[model samples]
Target: MCGRADDHFGPLGWQVLNGLFGYQGWELESMRDEVRPTDPIRFVRRTGAGFEAPFGRWGLVPPRMTLDEARKFATFNARIESLHEKPMFRAAFQAQRCVIPIAGFWEWPTSAGVKTKVRITRKDSKPLLVAGLWNCSQTPDGPLESCTIVTRPPTPDLIDVHDRMPALLLSRDIDAWLDAPPIRAREVALASWQPRILQVTPA
Candidate 1:
């Protein structure tokens, strides 16, 4: 269901605007195809409004992997329930959390090989927070950056299209995940009462 996301939009996807968000080994100047800050059109979700920090394309390559090895697996998805145990994601899962504010995302239903894309947006029409993990891994050239979105089991409405859905944090629950102690992070991620039961609108 969930696949590559085109987050290009306005007013909703900025974490830090007019600046670059770099971590320990993130190569600010040497990224493969870095986007300029002046570009009026780019994908972002406003964190506190007015801040836009462009991100590298989604998909993560753990630093431990070699060039050939990384190609085998790395995409825009991660299972929220197994993050702490998945070899490729555990380290970043514990250390590098991020917020992927979305206008919405796409899911596709495929029969044999043909696919039909469906847009899934929030019923309330507000941006949704998708939990993420980021990493800057060592490559032959140097360190390269990548990220992955966390996912949970699909809700009933979404099950028809895909077996799983991205791990989404409700507007009321964003702070709870980001600020919660480690012991509570897992619990918060799996909360049923928060009800991520979003009303889906066809795009």
Candidate 2:
């Protein structure tokens, strides 16, 4: 999330994201996207060729209706099994895919009025690249960005608490998902969550 994350780094969050691969804030001034305090932070994809900045919101708002309609689908997650066909998300699946990196996520379970939250992380506790999709829209207010994290069938360990989990990508798939003009659904899954293993600890 551009503006909605805990990993923010003052005015240089953009620098950190773009330079994450190697530069380490080396290309700080090149990115033109402004930081906003919201979900889905925008950043530049610095490739061997150059940099391309895209504006995608943290939540996806598919095309088809008025500005009022967008609010109905500002969801943070999309079920992976149905991404290719879901009316609200299909367009982005083929055209505007993205990558979201996270150290982990929190899940809450409730039973008999008791609620507990557990934090899940990789065995190594490293960051994961969560696959996502996004879109840019124009309203009377000008342009706005949004996105949705794709979710796959939950691991057996997590299924009891939730039926779905974000479709996470391996580092090897980073180039394809974030840079491909169009990514195949099946291929996306293979490059993404198939081998991911995670652990959940009580929060």
Candidate 3:
């Protein structure tokens, strides 16, 4: 499960976002070095006109759920295998797909009876675009948007680090992920499981 990540994508990262989605100068709610579940994070979602980047709670809150009830279960990571079968994710999976751009992510790997905190990032150091689903739920304060990262079985390179890894998209695949039909989107998700060079170091 990818429970922690970094969103401090600087100028170059912003350039990449601009190139991919034409993301203009929209401001983030907050940019953190370490973003945890339930914290506000930036994600790009499909809009009628185009794509828009917005801040949303890291844990997904289904439209039918109340904030109190949503807190009762783990909603930060949605398993790819059961997305269509799970009530909490089914609707969003079909319509509210999103991409979460992170500089890198953290994982704890156990070795020799010790757990080591490590950071995993693209070998090229480009931003990692994580596939996810988003939904809006009415809260007492108002409507709140939340998202859950999609996770699948780890690629061979990442198997030693964790049993699962965030489903990632290449820059070219973003359009299909956000605009394609559910069945086609699932194909894109499945195709993303190929191995890629990654840099993992002790954090």
Among these predicted structures, which one has the highest lDDT?
3
lDDT rank order: 3, 2, 1
Model 2 lDDT per residue over 107-191, tens place: 6767688888676667764555677777778778888777667777765667765666767777677677666654454466544
What candidate 1 gets wrong by more than 4 Å, as runs, is: 12-54, 110-115, 192-203
TM-score of each: 0.68, 0.70, 0.94
Error of 2 at 65 (Å): 3.5
Which candidate ranks first by TM-score, i.e. highest?
Answer: 3
Give Cα-based local distance difference scores for all models.
0.57, 0.60, 0.87
Query: Stretches of candidate 3 above 4 Å error?
Result: 24-30
lDDT of 2: 0.60
**Per model, how many backbone clashes are there?**
11, 7, 0
Candidate 1's TM-score reads 0.68
Candidate 1 has its poorest 10 consecutive residues by lDDT at: 32-41
